[model samples]
Target chain A: MEAQKVLTPSKREQQKEARRNAIINAGYQEFALQGFTATKLDDVAVRAGIGKGTIYLYFDSKETLFQEVIRKNLFPIRDEAQSYAAEFKGTATEHLTSHFRRMYQALHQDRMPELVQLVMGEGLRFPEIADFFFREIISSNQELIQGIIKKGVEDGEFRESFNAEFTQILIAPAMVSALWRLQLEKQSPLDIEAYADAHIEFILRGLKA
Target chain B: MEAQKVLTPSKREQQKEARRNAIINAGYQEFALQGFTATKLDDVAVRAGIGKGTIYLYFDSKETLFQEVIRKNLFPIRDEAQSYAAEFKGTATEHLTSHFRRMYQALHQDRMPELVQLVMGEGLRFPEIADFFFREIISSNQELIQGIIKKGVEDGEFRESFNAEFTQILIAPAMVSALWRLQLEKQSPLDIEAYADAHIEFILRGLKA
Candidate 1:
């Protein structure tokens, strides 16, 4: 009986989420077009069809609104990775192939490339915000990956001699490769996941006993 | 007799080196303090005790001057790595180990921690510049490292299973760990080379056959 009142989201919660989503959509549109520094709250408010005061109620400032937009954009990535963790029941190798494939999909989504540049660019200025994303989104998720490798090692399903700590260096270059192709080589966008899966396979071959 | 004219260090050449050194020193001091964006030629000239126009004689512009600064800063690194490579007489393992250690040491130099931040931070606004450094300085160096590894695999010094591509990944995380320390953890004023050496050792241990 006492739990009933707290179990369900209040109407206020629904209303607040609605307002936040509206603000996030506005923020993304503005950030993508004007770049982050040049973007203004008034522009977001006008785009959202909300008053400037209404935006303030939802977000403390433009920075905070930008942070939420980033957070929301990252949610799909987090959700998919988490879902992969749950659904994966095969060898860690198989799981990794599937897992990395999903990650590349997230990485290559429309506007995701620009979003990466935006995140990295802003990360230089607002490191605290970036740290928040790193801790909540990247490092913690990386721990899940480490757990899979650790399990594989323990079960003797794979080699016992890989350094999980340093694997990010291997994985990251492929992402950097994609960025390079787009930024430097100016190649028509290939399937980044296909490239990532091949890269992961290349590492797996080296790690195999 | 005619060859002597070209062989001798003309007063102009000597003066050029002196001016060039002044510009590099100014670049380091200014880039270290204000980062690339906030840096200006007039300010660097003031710091170097040279007239602004005088600096232009030595360096074409701030961009070219900064590139020269990067090259000058890396000279010791290249020399150290060359010394290590010269000292090694054994098979592939010895060469790869010594070569990597020297590179890591260069990355961990006294002024490098702050300079790396400046490069990564301000490099954001100038994609072409960051790409140039990565290609010419970093990626080309990795190709050298790969050549050593390939020689090892052929000589039976390392496992046939070794992946030169993945092995290349190990070289970079020494710098990434530094980025994590500075950019994320906010641990300022710590010696980064020590941190970098340990990171290199960790990677070497994993990559060792």
Candidate 2:
């Protein structure tokens, strides 16, 4: 009793985080394989090696847990891409192309491509989660690219008239690449690296000062 | 009696076409609103004002009906865009821009934006429909753009390096616009016309000879 009571609050918090992460990992794997509609909360608990009741202690529902899985998996990748752009010492074209490449790479490497399908596939049915994702993921990422475009103009790499909304236009190729890879690639294979390079070339030439 | 007999064949053909069309339209409306998994054939039959058994006469299953709906609605628009590109008597930039504008316009006017959502959302689950779409709509559209790019290069308006596959990259912006308009517009309205113009400007500059 004395030894258990002596454990630090920070240690207790770490345990909670570990348990939470296990649940998230299991949720992502199950959801990716079976999709949003077919997945069950009980299976997630079994996969995580926890009691079904323990899942409720962490997540109110499967949707809530799925949201948490997206948050954990996608946020780090998004943040890393932002930091990579910030830290890069290159021309705006290089910076943007590298950022675009990294987004695709991370998406595939992390096996998060299914997440895109899930959002596009089921988001309409679940408006609140869709709204959360739009605000958090789509909006934030657009802003990041918009900022890069602004910087490119400031550095005299991109033309002054390049509308910031062109960021969306610029990244549109990457979007298609991700979606195609996840949902349509089996039928129509996209050579993603080549595609990305070509996209960068076109976009750079379009924006060149 | 002779007049009635003569009318029977053509009149029966017209009735068959009309019923097929009605089922397609009703399927589009219902599927667009409720999506594929949630939709029921009974509701579709009711909406089309046909016996539920009549639906089976025209379509083998709900999925087949949905596939026909996609084909009838999207194919005409795709063909019209192709025709528009062929008919345009202008510079390559003007031709491409006109085609781009027409795609967005038709997508919105026909209320087919939900189709993007449907394909993105359910395509993975239903591989047959996905494969059909990839082969027909996507591959054909990509080829149409490829032909335009080739013409642009031949006209000394665009560089020769713009490969046929570049067509996919070129059209990514329109894909994003359609998706954003359908899925995220309530939270963040996309001024689609302006977006299309900006896309045209950037793409034209990018492809300059």
Candidate 3:
């Protein structure tokens, strides 16, 4: 144990990298368990097996660490949405539905429920985080939905006067909460993918066809 | 001040009522200003101009006191949703649209945003409240929405294949955040009434005969 614990210059850098990862993992657990208000840097440091000073070497503040946790998790998923939406071409509703199916599947994945709770629960305290979400995640996906709906209407796949932006807003919250709710329950009548399929079907039925 | 402060038994009762009202008002302010975990009963009592014991006479606990504030303000409005929904008779879409319009207005009312914040912020820690809300509010309304959609499909006012339950799920969540976002400096354009109107319209267009 003593031999393995020693670090040279290059090994010190590797140890630093391990400490950074440990801090992030510890922060994620703390944020989830205690929420933002109750969580403390000291607790996180203890969990990470690092000193208060070592924790500072990687991140400046609790807020910054939490922000990075959010960024690390959110941007990749958002990028996934972009790539999925980009690959489709067909009826606007169909194209949009494919993207939603993928997004819904991702959202139904285990980590997302905790993330949703963190965001929805804490977003009120930090209005800026809500802004970040709207700008970086919701608004972009909404625009893509709007574009697809617009194209659908234009191509005579949907009714000519269909309003895409409004539809996105109308459908978004339900879609966001549905999976979260299903997870909250012990046994839902439907799993998330089934719910997503049903949701897309429901939306298609509601939109101007 | 002399006349108001006079303490006959009748006057004593009046003063007690006024003080209780003051306490509840103070509680709401404190809870909203600092959130539940940070808010102290002493601050509430101080703001109310009464002993904390006086607060106990009027309300059983801090949780109860907060619940009372919410119940007093919101229940009447919430109760109206059912009666309003009960009165409508038309095409299924028309009936459902009219029902949601009332709900949109109710959830969008100024009282609801802070109340919603209170629910999400504190309610996560106390899931009993969320459970009560689900039983008292969402469950009944969901049934009504589903019933209408079911009837509409049967009558051919909507597409015969309409997914009744998930459609209601889709109807929620967009307008859910409206009132809370109301006082924010930069709100999403998807507002309560606008989103409701758009949703009702979209659903109609998608399902219309």
Candidate 4:
């Protein structure tokens, strides 16, 4: 009887977790398609194949749902990057090259470019979303790159005068590539791999000790 | 009587030009403040201190007004950049440095960053605006930078192997800086001068033979 009772709750818990994920996946699609302001919770519920109230059970408001969508989709990538940087053992140049390649892969696989577009497009109008994005994504990414640069400088692989704070400059090419894909991909298709290689080569040459 | 007739039409033409400028200026403010979708022509008319019908006399729709806004404000800057590059007399390094400095000045003075934010934020939802922006602003800018890189390479100031087609990387920092100001300036204030200097130094070193 006790085993039955425990198994029943576990089954219920599994159902609940599944429902939550369905809502988030639907939210991602809706937000990506309709943007922040235009996305209706009812539409998300329909997409998720759930009742409208079910979304309320999982997420209190549209803002919270959007936050969860970002958290679910982006936080994993950020965490992976952090751990990857922590355990990386190689010359900084190799690390950066490999890291950028992986980043482009992520951009291709994950719809990260769309998310970046959503944030840049809607962020100023929604300051809270902007703040959350900066805190959750931008700052973490900046820290990861800055750590790599500092380590490179310490190991005498990079110029002593290289300002680690200017990691933005180092990463600007990737951001620009993403923006290009979103804005001008049809009119001007970019060779992203070649672009990535150029960026990596330019930075390494510029920062050589 | 003949002189009066000529003067009358010229005076009317001057008035028409003045009114057109007022409408464009008002459209800029509305678009910047409220974004593209949310901006209404009625509000723009009020802002321009004209009747609602008068805006229609000048602009067929909000899209047309927005296009005019972008063209009037951005085309001048692009034209000046073209002329500056054509007339520039110095090494490529000197020219780029001065060009970047002037670009920054325009970004600060002309509210160009806000316009960039507007286009990036709302461009995807409106494909026509995106297409217009790509044609009017982005292509010209890329061509200008490509021309400079080509000149530098030919003159032996830059590496012979440098790819002028990758001019996007050369100009990415400035775009990133503009975006950073729009998004994260409150959280992290960037010194624009130092940022521009870093960008120029990094690119020069990266491209130098």
TM-score for every candidate vs. truth? Answer: 0.71, 0.89, 0.83, 0.93
Per-residue lDDT over B1-209 for candidate 3, one digit per residue giving the tens place of the 0 to 100 score: 66655654466787877887898788877876677777899999998878888888988888988777766666777577777767776877678777767767776665566666666555655666666655665567677878887888788786665456554355555445453364333755545556566766766665665
Each prediction's interface RMSD?
4.8, 1.9, 3.5, 1.5
- Give lDDT tens digits, candidate 2, residues A1-209: 66766675467788899899999999998888677877888898899999989888999888899888888887887788777767888777777777777776876675677777777677546878779888878877888778778889999888888778646787777766777887688987888778877887887888889
RMSD of 1: 6.1
Give one digit per residue, the lDDT tens place, for model 1 in B1-209.
67865898777888888877987998898886666656888898898888899987877878788777877886666555655665668777667766766665666566786666656545534666676666656556666777777777687665555456543345545555545555555523334555544454544444455
Q: Residue B116's C-alpha lDDT in candidate 4?
A: 78
**Model 4 scores what on Cα lDDT?**
0.83
Q: Lowest-lDDT window of 10 residues in candidate 1 chain B?
A: B187-196
Which pairs clash inside model 2?
A121-B121
TM-score of chain B of each: 0.75, 0.88, 0.76, 0.91
Candidate 3 similarity to native, TM-score: 0.83
**CAPRI accuracy category, model 4:** medium
Q: Taking chain A by itself, what TM-score does each prediction score?
A: 0.80, 0.85, 0.80, 0.92
Residue-level error in angstroms, candidate 4, position B167: 1.2
- Rank order (by lDDT, best first): 4, 2, 3, 1
Of the two candidates 2 and 3, the one with more favorable lDDT, higher being better, is 2
Instruction: Quantify all predictions' global Cα lDDT against the true fold.
Output: 0.66, 0.80, 0.68, 0.83
Candidate ranking under TM-score, highest first, comes to: 4, 2, 3, 1
Across residues B59-121, which tens digit of lDDT does each residue of candidate 4 receive?
Answer: 888888888898889889989988998899998878877887887777766667778777877
lDDT of 2 by residue, B144-169 (tens): 77777888898899988765675778
Query: On lDDT, who's better, 1 or 2?
Result: 2
